[model samples]
Target: MSTSVGEAVVGVILAGGMASRMGGGDKPLFTLAGRPMLDSVLERLAPQCSRMVLSANGDPARFANYGLPVVADPVTGFVGPLAGILAGMDWAARELPAAELIATVPGDCPFLPRDLVSRLSEARRAQVADIALAASGGRTHNVVGLWPVALRDHLRQAIVAERLRKVALWTSRYRTVSVPWVEGPIDPFLNVNSPGDLEEAERLARMLES
Candidate 1:
């Protein structure tokens, strides 16, 4: 297993969302530059993580070719990304018992930074915080954060007992830090939410390729 700052780290791609904005169905399956969006994500994240899993529901067969384990939300009713986070923690705890942390990234973001895990680990250590999230262009991407496996129980309590949905709201209750990244022509955190956004991402992809 790969280690981020001497601690084994696992990566989880949050794909459990119902992409109503993009007319539904697997948004990660959508192509970017003739390859699946998940392919881009995997390509960027694979080097940073020892093992990776997809936090997705429904038929796992859809992602069978990727070969990574597909975990459904542990909580029922599509409890949002928090559920995915908790599920990731649970999975890592079970499958990757040696892993000290799990880092999460959105599935639709094809341009996630190469230094994502190391930077977040550095931010978490420097700030002495329980969690560290990515921020770009003065905006924090709550879902794009590093979570400790030890906090899994508390997260479950927050999601189950308190009905927590908003990621920022839940993260607010913890010691969280945001690691900022320099913005260039394209933001590493740029994600595809709509068809227009996908087209824009395609343009950015071409620019990146060139």
Candidate 2:
């Protein structure tokens, strides 16, 4: 197994969302401050993860240029982010045997905090929790959290056999903890779901890079 917090974790970019609100296209491919939003997610996370995978569905060829393994949700239909996360877990087991945990973030969340994995790891370890999640402005970013690969089977059962869909409901079964980040000039976990959200993200991006 990998030794360190960041190195021990595999990053899962949850790009499987159906961007119906953003006019029905891949939100990750949408331009944000002159580049694809996925680029921004990668820039912040690549260094902090031992390996990274894109959790998306329908035509993996669309993301071939990124050179990352793109895994689709094993479940049929767009169940939810939980299925995408499960796909990442299954991928890590087969491809990255050393990865003990997987950290996740929405693909459209271009401003993901640089310290995301480190902080989540620390929180999980310190609290002896099964899962560690990111919270900003008093709200937890459910998809943006660290999950154990050992629980992939249990998670699969939760989704497949139990029909568990909500992240909160699934996480509540464990000793889940949330690490808070101060949201200020820019909410580091901001995501783009609509055109207006994307426009706002442009301004946040300028502020972040400035």
Candidate 3:
């Protein structure tokens, strides 16, 4: 399979959440179907990206084996997924200077679409949008998106000056497009936020594997 669409695109798995709903810990690290959930996400996303990084906080040792860089939120005080997205952008700017864009997907989501980066890239190019986000079942997955690296500075300004918190709020200022995916047997953006959700993911894993 052609894993990379272009050398100018990088992937970032947003994993910085406090995971309070799962009782305070790394939700991506939680085991699902006998494997770490993040591993499944990486498997699907890494091939599509020329390079990939993990947007996470705390000790990076837990993810040491993955070999991908773990970037902490540049903005302090747990600013949510948008912070993670910004961190990813900054990392791409610094490490992959040739990269034009960064694609983000929540680490807790193991069933991310295999064509995620390419479809988002195509949608953004076709629409001439500043950003391209994933949507399913009539709901937008703001955390799962394609962001222009050029927007990093502006995003930093909004976060610092306006205290921007919501992804939709900041994205509204730019020309953005949402690529809707069909909810097959299950939503590709399905994420694990709680213990019960993990159980459901495990069940989904079995179904998808078969």
Highest TM-score against the true fold, candidate? 1
Clashing pairs in 3: none
In candidate 1, what are the lDDT values of residues 1-210, reduced to their tens digit? 464566789999999878899889999999999989999999888788889999999999999999999999998897789999998999999998998899999999999999899999998999999999999999999999899999999999999999989999988998999999997889999989999999999999999889
TM-score ranking from best candidate downward:
1, 3, 2
The digit string of per-residue lDDT tens for model 2 on 37-93 reads: 899999889888888899999999999899999999998877899999899999999
Residue 208 in candidate 3 has what lDDT?
A: 81
Q: Regarding lDDT, does 1 or 3 come out ahead?
A: 1
CA lDDT, every prediction? 0.92, 0.90, 0.89
TM-score of each: 0.97, 0.96, 0.96
- List of clashing residue pairs for candidate 1: none
Query: How far does residue 155 in candidate 3 sit from its true spot (Å)?
Result: 0.4
**How far is each candidate from the true structure, as Cα RMSD in Å?**
1.0, 1.8, 1.3
lDDT of 3: 0.89
Candidate 3 residues 1-210, lDDT tens each?
A: 233566578889998888898788888888888988999998899889888899999999999988889999998887888888889999998998988898999989999989998899889989999999999999999989999999998999988888989989999999999999999999999989888889899899999889
Q: How close is candidate 2 to the true structure, as a TM-score?
A: 0.96
User: C-alpha displacement of 24 in model 1, angstroms?
Assistant: 0.9
